[model samples]
Target: MSKIRKKKIKKTNILLGFICILLAVLLGFILVTSYKSEQKESRHLSEIADDQQSGIEDYEAVKERAKELEEISSEEAEDTEDTKDTEKTDTADTEDADKTEDTKDKTTAASGIVCWGDDLINGEESNTYSYMTVLQKLLTDNGYNMTVINKTLQGGGTLSMMKMAGVSDETIQSYITKHQQAANGAQLNVTETGIRDLTEEQTTRNDMDCIPVIFMGYYGGWNHDPAELADQQEQILNTFQNKNQFIVVGTRPMDGSVTSEALDQVLSQKWGEHYISLADVTAQPSSTYEAQQAMAEAILQKLQELNYISKN
Candidate 1:
């Protein structure tokens, strides 16, 4: 082997080694570039996945909010319905109450005679000659209604007669209890108290639509002066007029004294059609049953004349 040949072989081996190194470096660079590109692609894909997840969460949240809104609207509708139903019930109750009040008013109007006077008007054991019984039967037969209130006392005069007119029985009893004579001989001035009480009662009677029929002079007992009796009668008429009440004046049948006749004349003159003459109706000994019936008929005729009842 020659030295020159050996050296050439050595140089060739070195050159081949250098070429191999260059090829290895190029392969490493290609691998590194591919790995970097893959890493970048993976990062972009991860970001896209995150964005998709966020979008899904937002959509779910929107659906949940819509469901909440639907629930709120449904509750509001239910509340509105309940409010309307309550209003309807309240309106119905008000209508019913108004109807009830109207019915009560009608019933009150249908009942008759707010006030009346005399001992005959008081309740007692019935006899055929009883004035109240006969009058009641006559009025009922004529299709007329009568509500009588008796305010009679043993010694009651014209002033004390029917003093509690239009007042309830309980109230009249209470008033009587207060005005009764004392054990020490102190007695209430019956006439003055009666006038005052009657004035007060007139105010109440004015509100009730009914007639006030008064039978006077039984308690006068021929004691009261004729002129004074006339003046008192005039006062009564004026008071009733002031209260807007129409009065029906009548005389007692049994007490046919001069004073009674004079008072009847004055009442006839003053009251005209409102005056009822018991003497003209029935004769003085009217305690008989037939006389009482005749008296009731006469009174009924007078009421018919006044147009308080239909003539038919």
Candidate 2:
């Protein structure tokens, strides 16, 4: 081989080697930059994943807190309902106790007697001294605590007459005046007193505990129709039941020849335990002073039994 050719070949080889080295350096730089960029991307992705995980954990915690709050609310609602029920029960019990106390006080503070009847109780035949006086004396002697106000009238009709009259101040005043006059030993003209006045006085008084009505017949005789008398008596009794008054009923003895068995049955059926038959105490159709006294005793006993007056 020629010398010049050999030298040229060596130069060419050296040049080629330098060029390859330069290419290799550039390739290394590119690879390093690419690797750095990949690493940065990977780190960014990891941060995003961590953020997603934290968000999921936060959501789970929020859900748990909401559940806890719901439980607390439910418990509080139940406690409120229980408290309301207890309060209602306590209020009902208090009301019942108050009602019972009021009833007891009313019974303890009760007083006064309103005597209402016909000539049998008005002492028309006994010189203006009737069974009412006997009853008052008996009650006073037996420790009965009350004021007796006699308002009996001569020829007083059925209970219906009293119911129809109603209550009035004038009637009450008249009775009070008569009572005062009697207390002062003034002779009273009992015949002038009407049935209407007696009934009005009975209905007007607020202090009376008991009012016993003795009915014989209308117009001072048992000659009236039995059915008509019974019906009127029934009406009066029903009306009196609606009133704020305690009432007792009594029947006077009629003529033995007269059929009073029907009337007695009606009184027993209508009044039940509140009825008193004077036939058992007196045999005479018209009551005498002794009979009136006996009737007064019976009336007092009946009042005690009916709880209108305390049995001492």
Candidate 3:
């Protein structure tokens, strides 16, 4: 055959072998790169899954805590005949109440007042003289045994106040939750008043047979819609299990001046003598201890005038 032909064939074979090796190396590098990419992507997805799981756990825990804070107990029903007719026979009804609200009644079944309000009514934890507290003290000092059960907290707006007052209506709760500003004392900023001793008596929830004094309207405008807030306040009054004499106390609006004025007028008209305004008691109602004293005096005066308590 031919030596040159054999050598040429051998050279072609060598070239083909080199090409095969190069292709194998390139394929291995591509597979290694693909494996590394898959690993990186898997790790990223796992991290995201873990973070989402943690967030869900935190959210569930917060929901549980909120449920606890909003729990309301059913109060024992009392002979609330005196509370049923607050305005119909104002002079006569309260005259009868006076007999039961005096010293003898104190020794028998102590008088109670369930107060529903905001920071102004609850005051701060540091000051023990919330309007309800001071009003209770004033009544006790004046020969009457009165217990004011403060159902309120700081930043507690009308909606949250209603929730804490045993209101479980879904539509109402949803409306408030969506509308109220978180920064204000609307929801989640709840703190309950501990059982306290007033003079010789320990105060208990008197909702079963007690006067409910509602002093709301602290959060508005930037905090919440003043009109909606007023509506919520009205709704709160209806949540009472007993149809009792409920006092509606109004506050000076924090913001939304125009709507606030309108709200004030509407409240006054609807409630009539059953309503009281903080503006009438103080130039500017506040959470201050002094303001609370003024508030107490105002409430005491109202009770005396209404014959809810003995003028003597």
lDDT of 1 by residue, 123-143 (tens): 344344555567667778777
Better of 2 and 3 by lDDT: 3
Give each model's whole-structure lDDT.
0.56, 0.59, 0.63
List RMSD in Å for every model shown.
14.8, 11.9, 28.9
Number of backbone collisions per candidate, in order? 0, 0, 1
Ranking by lDDT: 3, 2, 1
* TM-score versus the correct structure, for each prediction: 0.43, 0.47, 0.51
- Judged by lDDT against the true structure, how good is candidate 1? 0.56
lDDT tens digits, residue span 1-312, model 2: 999999999999999999999999999999999999999999999999999999999999999999999999999999999999999999999999997777555544555665554656332454444777777888899998766665555555443244443534454345445444554765433322333444455555453343434444524222233544444454444433223234444453343333446656666675667667666667654456776777778878877775666644
Candidate 2 lDDT for residue 104: 51
User: Which portions of model 2 show Cα errors greater than 4 Å?
Assistant: 1-108, 121-129, 167-247, 252-258
What lDDT does candidate 2 reach at residue 66?
99
